[model samples]
Target: MNKIKNIHILILLIFLISIGQMSQTIYVPSIFNIAKELKVNMEEVQKLMSGYLLCYGISQLIYGPISDKVGRKPVILVGMMIFILSTFLILFANSLELMIILFSIQGLGTGVGGVMARTLPRDIFLNYENLKKANGFLNMGILVSPLIAPLIGGIISNLFEWRMCFVFLLIIGILISTTIFIFLPETCTKKQIKNSIFGYKILIYKKKFNYYLLILTSGLSGIVVFESNSGVLLSEMGFSNIEVSILFILPIPSIFFGSWYIGFSKKSFNYLMWKSVILCLLSGFFMWLPGWFKIMKIWTILIPASLFFFSAGMLFPLATTGAMIPCKGSAGTAGALLGGIQNIGSSFIAFISTFLPKNGQFSIGMITFIIGVIIFLCWWKLSRLEKI
Candidate 1:
């Protein structure tokens, strides 16, 4: 019975962690539909993602501390309620501005998942090996959202309308919230740290943690920039919505492989970090080289982008575990900062990508290259420092 319960909890946590990414990506295939329906331009419609991401990232700062003070369950429940309400309300938003507002609110709600998913694993798994295994498994499951969400979004948008996408999210919100309310127990045992600032200071003071955080942020931002721009780029290349959705799935397998490899490999974290950084730099080179010669094709984009995704897959788990393991006592705060800062960085990059000239994939390639360079520099600095 205890084994069965553990399995159940793991499954639930997977769902909880997946909600944030699912919310972000499921409606992505509908961006063009949204722009046309709301009489907005591409830049304006992209705000829906940027707005949600900004609030999603920022709200974790609050949820993380509160979950530590209160319990994880209540904070999660409240966030789900907020997400459900906002998702339902978004279905009625006829203007881009209104939709952006509701989406941002929805982000605020889903942000709880971002904090708790990482924190709860720390709370439940006392052993480091067990925690690392759980995190790797959770990350593998999280990858499924991006794999399937755009496909679903494309099919729904093509058959019905984009608003139905929100309807689907509403249903999912109700089910997840209900399940959590019934089954999830409060996992935080040490809630004595009342001052959130102290927790922040503890984490921020660590040089290793700061370096890992920036490395994670830079790699993740490349993903956001690609996802933020890819649909429109593919559409311009004459692909239909469904086709674009299919193409989005192409790079995901590489990510899955990278995630799987990290679990079994005996390589030092530093070695793996360097390997991933090199792959990203190579990925960036491929991404940029094609655009430089005006020979950008579907394969050029997808194949090179897969290299980056593979690197990200490796980077996320390593960087997260490297940063979080040392701060186990302040799991909630550390989880919040880890998740929050990365999303906030990605949100900033995504917002900026919208303003870049839409020049046959040059913008995305350049952005990816730039991010790779940034990651390399951060990793070099981190490599010189002593491990925490």
Candidate 2:
């Protein structure tokens, strides 16, 4: 394939994979809507989202090395196909249990897309400058999904019905998979394909990589906690579905702006990561402290939460890029490991956030504070080790 063709295909690839992710988020407000329609508890429907996340996070480990073994194009094609089928199942879901099952499969399928989305960039761009640009583009693609999906969900659910969301996703998934089958060429080399699973195992045993993973683990835990539970929080506070949609957009502006500036800057990843980590910790502390005197309100929650994501918007790319940088031979495996560990960390935090006392703001505050402390300690250790 020609270079221009490859670049276009890559962009399409990123966009399609991103849209798959956008399918998941477009329904945050719809969770409450779905629960109400199906006569299921709202929190139960919330678990559908959580279950999707669990599969989304863990399945990356499976798909990452698989892509390394076979090829990026095939893995991506397979994932999209699975997602397409899952969405079809969801469209017919009348019971909540069926919805959760469909959501899990949707998650499992898109999980591969997420892994390949990051890994493909590394395959395409070898130079640090180009690689950084690729990472920025990848982040942008993913970030834009959440920005637009909720609005679309609100409109579609209000005008037609919630089932249209799944119908739309199903069509999009099939279209994306077909495009990949027709367009994308293989990126992984034959040498890289030999016993890729063994390579994945070896990469996991690397000690230095653990520090980078820890940094990601700590930061993402905070983000996941908010992502999994924030919908319910807002709903419980009496925000209507459309109102929740409007409020959901509040966080993305800060995240996008912060990432754009930092991602383009020439600052070292180590410095950026540390600075963002400290900001995250501070945000967590401030978020927690406000509730102690019972001063917590919507703005108080949104402001600090946005700040945490803003810092995350800065730090996450660095942590992801940094973790993969140290991998000498198996970049795909390394990418997978970084992503997989980050998901595991996020899931752990989500679980904690779920059971935390919802009686008052104190529980949520405490969880955020603890996550911030963990991130701070991890960043300090990483800085010391790197002599940064």
lDDT of each: 0.83, 0.73
* Model 1 TM-score relative to the real fold: 0.95
Candidate 1 structure quality by residue, lDDT tens digits, 314-375: 88777777777876677889989988998899999999999987768788999999999988
Residue 184 in model 2: lDDT: 74
RMSD of each: 1.9, 2.3
Which candidate achieves the best TM-score against the true structure?
1
Off by over 4 Å in 1: 1-6, 190-195, 386-388
All candidates: TM-score: 0.95, 0.92
Candidate 1 C-alpha error for residue 113, in Å: 1.0
Off by over 4 Å in 2: 1-10, 191-195
Q: After superposition, how far is residue 336 of candidate 2 from its true place, in Å?
A: 2.0
